[model samples]
Target chain A: MAIVVVNVMPKPEILDPQGKAVTNAGKRLGHEGFSVRQGKRFEIEVGEVTPTVLEEVRHFAETLLANTVIESFEVCS
Target chain B: MRVGVVTFPGSLDDADARRAISLTGGEPVELWHASDDLRGVDAVILPGGFSYGDYLRCGAIARFAPVMDQIITRANQGLPVLGICNGFQILCEARLLPGALIRNQVQTFTALDQPLRVESTRTAWTSAYWEGQTITIVLKNGEGNYQADPDTIAQLEDEGRVVFRYLGNPNGSLNDIAGITNQRGNVVGLMPHPEHNVDPTITANLDGRPLFTSLADYLLGATC
Candidate 1:
């Protein structure tokens, strides 16, 4: 079986409150000058990795896994 | 008039929406997410709550439910539809309405009786209220912040499609928008739970009663 990973992140223009909260916590913990942005990762299990499979997964990521209006997704094998 | 309230898994306010419709002298029909049938209702309401456990994203999974197919088809055909809270999110995801609802800017789930001004009374759902009328309704949710592209925002403003604007600008919504309608004014989506404020016995105010009454008035006038 092959696995493909898709990562989704909030668009830069959209607010990422969770990421900001985490960054604030890091600051409280004495980690300064570093920032973090949060996103979601999805791993899809497939019988085999092929061009068609990759395309299909990309479609899934775009249509289901991520809302394109506020987020962007990347498909990785 | 008959108003249908769709109930998806984890929906908490479907009953309240139905009750509100009934109180407004309209028949209430219950629609299920797993069914494609709309039961021939004159209007449909998508109520608040976490559907499909709010998985992936709020209203994202519910947008693909079987019932949504029927709702989308009917809504595009000029059927009056109202989406509240999570329902608003579903409407955006279904592209029935412009913009997406994101997490509150403060990163907290906010619940309050929010003050809002009627921006436009041209929509099927807001015709009972006069333009610029200020009213208060129950606002409760985590992802209630509304956002859209600059062009879409401009178009909405230019067209006077903004239905409701928050008087106090809670949750950091763009232009203080609490609700909006489509170009045809048949479909509207808002983050506040108007159904929760319809009954004065249960709630302290009846500010939401006008929303249901407005739909009833529209349907009655349409049939006349």
Candidate 2:
């Protein structure tokens, strides 16, 4: 079995409160001068990995897994 | 007039929306999100709630529901539709409305009586109110920040399609926009629970009654 992973993150111009909160938490934990942005990861298991399958997963990531309005997504096999 | 209120799996305010419609003397039709039929209602209302558990994102999964397919088709044909709170998120996801609603800047769920200025009284939903009228209604949501690209914001402003503006900017929405209408003025999306303020017995504020009355008047072909 092969798995395809998709990573989705908020667009740069959009505000990500969850990411800001995580950065602040990291600061409280003594990690300074670091910024973090939260995002989502989805793994799709398939019988076999192929170009066609990767394209299909990319389509799903664009249309459903991530909202293009406030998000950007990347697909990897 | 018949106004259909859609009820998705996690829709919490469908009953309140239906009640508001009934109180306004319109027949309330219950529409199921899993079904594609709208029951031939004169108008449709997508009420507030965390539909489909708000997975992936708020209203992301719910946007693909069978009912939304019909709504998208009918709305394009000039059918009147109103989306409230989570429904607003769904509308943006479905591309019926411009922009997106993101997590609140404070990263917290907020609930309060919010004051809004009516920016436009020309849509099917706001005809009963005078332009610039201020009304207070319930505002409750965790992800209610509205964002759009600069060009779209400029166009909405130039065209006067912004239907409502927040008086105090509760959720960090762009330009303090609380609600907006489509170019055709048949569809509206807002991140406030107007239905919650319609019943006087439940809440002393009846500011939301005008929204239902506006639709009723519009359906009756009355010039408000």
Candidate 3:
């Protein structure tokens, strides 16, 4: 079984509402160093997960997990 | 015609999408996230909302849903696949459509009756409108601006793949693109909610009705 970690985010130019909301809230609370965005992680156990299998998994994540419009994904084993 | 609408965990518009299909004279079948089968539907619609609560990006997590596998396979076989908002994001992630929905350059979640120019009536969806015709539909999303590398944008422009353009730039999308059709013209992705426009009780504009109407016309024996 291999573990996969994926990080997804809107491309730099895109506005992140959730991030912005957090940033604003941090400012209100006087929290320092608040530059925040969000993404997710999924851990799955697969059989002999070769590179091709990983790619397929990534494609699956691309098609379903992350919205490609605003988010990009990177997969690590 | 029978249509399948896939439901990701956080999908918010699956029910509405089904209702829209019913209103348009298509039978809507619900497919689950983990199942790879398409339930023998003629077309597929990836509805809007934060799948996985936008946990890993809007449509990121939903892309891996088993149903999408079937969708991608059948879409290549010439099945119609329509992605709206978050659904559009999933298509982009899937590479079935090029470009990405970035955060609105203005950084705002815009929800309103947005005006769009029908750039092409050549796809499985949006076939009811005349080229260059304008219509209004509801657009509500936080990350909906469309962008791509310079060459890709130019290619899309040159190919006339752009299917919809904003009547007025609302999300800071390049060239005001609100929707696009894939090379085969069977897959389409748009940021607006045509489903919301199907019922007058739900939306002020009926402009979105044509989207479904055209789908009904073609899927149920109407001309291209």
Candidate 4:
């Protein structure tokens, strides 16, 4: 079995209210000259890693793991 | 006419949707998310709430429910389907509708009586209203902001498929689009809850009554 990790984030063009609010709070707390973007990370445990399994994971990532309209996802091995 | 209202486990507005249909003189059939059967209802309503506990993104998980698979098949066959608020989110997630709904621009949940103009009367749900008519309905959601690529927006505009446009920007939706219909006009998704405004006893006005009545009329017309 292999572990698959995926990261999902709001598209850069879209307004991310959560990220902005966090940036503001950081500024208030004296963390200066830095910004943060919030996103999600999912770790999955699957059977043997093969090209076919990887392709299936990619399909699921595009269609279900992330909504391409406003968000993007990246699959990491 | 009979309208089916499907209730996801956390649906908050299923009862309201059912009541709206009953008040409009249509039989209301209740369907469950786990069930694959549609019970042969003429139309369907996916009422609003935090389905699947709003986990992994709003409507993301609910879109894969067993019932939604059948809903998608029937919707493609031209069954009249309406998705409100969280239901709208689910529709987008399911790819039954275009675009996506993200967090509100204000970074908080917004709840208000949102005013909107009927942009088109060509849809199965908005046929009772004349073009350019204005009405108010309840809009409430944490992730109500709608987004889509520019080309898709142009297509929706060029086709005159936008069903409702906000009178004022409530959640920073692009083009002020409060509601939209698919190319076939059989499916619609909107952020506002028309069901909340259907009964005068619950609300002061009945701006939403027309939507239910419109469907009832359309179904009756189809049978004749």
For model 4, residues B130-158, the per-residue Cα lDDT tens digits are 99999999999999888899998999999
Better of 3 and 4 by TM-score: 4
B57-113 per-residue lDDT for model 2 (tens digits): 999998999999999999999889999999999999999999999989878899999
Q: What DockQ does each prediction reach against the true complex?
A: 0.87, 0.90, 0.33, 0.85
**What TM-score quantifies how close candidate 1 is to the native fold?**
0.98
Highest lDDT model number = 1
Per residue, candidate 4 scores C-alpha lDDT tens digits across A1-77 of: 79988899988988888998999999999998868889989887889778887788889888888888888898888
Question: Can you write out model 3's per-residue Cα lDDT over B92-168, one digit (the tens) per residue?
Answer: 87788988777776677899888888998888887788998978888999888888777878988899999999988
Q: Candidate 1: DockQ?
A: 0.87
Tell me which of candidates 2 and 4 scores higher on TM-score. 2
TM-score chain B for all models: 0.98, 0.97, 0.95, 0.98
Itemize residue pairs with steric clashes in candidate 1.
Answer: none
True-structure RMSD, every candidate: 0.9, 1.4, 4.6, 1.2
iRMS of candidate 4, Å: 0.9
Q: What TM-score would every model get versus the actual structure?
A: 0.98, 0.98, 0.78, 0.97
Candidate 2 chain A: worst-modelled 10 consecutive residues by lDDT:
A46-55
- CA-based DockQ, model 4: 0.85
